[model samples]
Target: MNDIRLYLFQSGSQLCKVHDIKMNQGCGQDMEIPVPWFLLMHPKGNVVIDGGLAAEGLADPRGYWGDAIDAYRPRMRPEQGCVAQLATLGLSPRDIRYVALSHLHCDHSGAVGRFPDAVHLVQRREYEYAFAPDWFAAGAYARKDFDRAGLRWQFLDGEAGQPFDLYGDGALQAVFTPGHTLGHQSFLVTLRNSGTMILAGDAVYTLDHWNETALPGLLASAVDAVRSVQKLRALAERSGATLVPGHDPEAWRRFRLAPGYYD
Candidate 1:
């Protein structure tokens, strides 16, 4: 039997309103939401889904983002550092064997430098976009941290239909669920005691978004995003796997949280 146990680590949480942006669901009003990033642990090994915004960026505004990053100042905080949270659980950065990123967004890839020894897994197309961003806007990718850490990287180049099995035993799988970004992906983790849990990265940011069939303002392609959500919802229904959204406030309350960890 696979003795797998899962842990939900709240690397960080942010409060933001929909009206903060120019696009407000076409209703000209704002909605309050809690944004959260998480980490998953298994008996076989620990895998960090997405690294939350780093403390450095939250501390000195002039250091990381001079003017372009000022828009997010109100919602970001240093108290939710992922590295520090890991220490609270008696697990160091070295304890993580794999760092599976949903995409290369600045918020999701902030603390990647914390785990230097782990193999950083990402889709090939996503890495390509991060390296050469001329096709889209520039500075969308943060490459400095990965370069600074001298971390080893692994690229998933499989076709969209087939899922990439990280452990080769069907215990942990990375599913290609692109939309918000070109190479965006989600993870389906099978636990021995808890069945299957699907980490729906930014593909489905919140359950409300899924229910309403609404797309976030920042999207590579709205059509693709909708399709990815349909696929995720179908998979979750067929497999009976608990779908965890990337930024759902109720995720911590609905699912089990790691001891001493708070959202």
Candidate 2:
């Protein structure tokens, strides 16, 4: 039996012009991709990867999302909230011991407050960039979604290019794939029968993007972004891991969405 179980949940969908995600491709066309949040069941504790959209945002996008609401246009359902989805597995936020954030982007960290007791794990630089006075210089970090009070935050400071093993065992680790954002990171999870799976969190938006080394519409550093993809490709080749992309509707169809799981 596998020591860790992984569940991929569709928290919601974010619709944006295709060019917004991948530069120059489908310039005037719109595409909607599922917003995914993962639940990892570990022997030591349960972990939530990316909190998805806030529950309130589901009912009132304009109120919570503001101007970006018109840009990203997230389509959320009440049942997709972290709390409701966890219930399907006979769990709750309190059951989560750690909430791992790939980055503090609104789509990724909106529901972080739901797991008040879980220790929130984020790259130190990513956390700092989220709160920096000029954090919005690149324009995606939303203060309303993050910057919540009382949640236990644990900063992980790992050397660039080095993967941080969250558990002593090699079952789970954080791969530093900076780009897309200053401190964007991906995760590598090792399962028993399933082998290895790489969760490429916005570092590589889609398989097409990965294949062509395409840049996103909004990017901090194109050079760094391409480097991140190259690193991920090499890692995937090295480990023979299945790379779970961040926001690719077509790519997402290949997976079994929760309440199904990969163990």
Candidate 3:
């Protein structure tokens, strides 16, 4: 029997321009996309993959995100925050043993601090970049979301340390997939009956980005982005794993939500 259960949760939704998600495609078109976070319930310990948007945004988007709100407007509900979503399962931040972050973007790392007892696993380069990002990505990283002194962190260097198996088991893996950012990563969860799942963080934004029809918006490196997308695609195809894209509204609808889990 599979000892792992995966649950999906939406922290909120963001209304953004097509070009904002996919590089230079839909200019004036508006798209409302779901911001999702995940939890993996394993016999060993629980892990949170990305924490979704910060709960503070629900109170005041402009005040929390500053000028960045103009580009990707947030529409968050009270029950959609990370804490609230976990509450439905009778779980809390303290219950999580580890937080495997894909990157340090404000949306992805917002609730990370709440898991004070959990070790925050991130790429070393990403850690450095988030604090001192270039002018182009200056608005994306909100330091306040993850800059707590007491929160614990576990850093992975490069490929050598990565595809890091959480709990020293083959069940959960942190796959280094840099491109969307300097230290971006993706995750792989293996279940006995439900098969394997590839959680493509921002590494592959949507099917358009996955299928190579369009590149993702705001690329740190176009070459790296393409390589990472193709790499993820190949991995999924080779292993017959379900590849879940980041910020895909259509994909989100198809997903089995919380209360319902994949074991």
Evaluated with TM-score, which candidate comes out highest? 3
Give RMSD to native, each candidate. Answer: 3.3, 1.7, 1.2
Candidate order by TM-score, decreasing, is: 3, 2, 1
Predicted structure 1, TM vs. truth: 0.85
Among residues 3 or more apart in sequence or in different chains, the pairs in candidate 1 whose N, CA or C atoms overlap within 3 Å are: 19-30
Model 3: how far is 192 from its true place, Å?
1.2
In model 1, how large is the Cα lDDT of residue 209? 58
lDDT accuracy of residue 28 in candidate 2: 83
123-165 per-residue lDDT for model 3 (tens digits): 9999989889999998888888888889889999766744888
Tens-digit lDDT string for candidate 2 (63-124): 77677777798888888888898998899768989889999888898558787678888898
TM-score of each: 0.85, 0.94, 0.96
- lDDT string for model 1 (191-221, tens) is 6666777888888877755775467656677
lDDT of each: 0.69, 0.82, 0.87
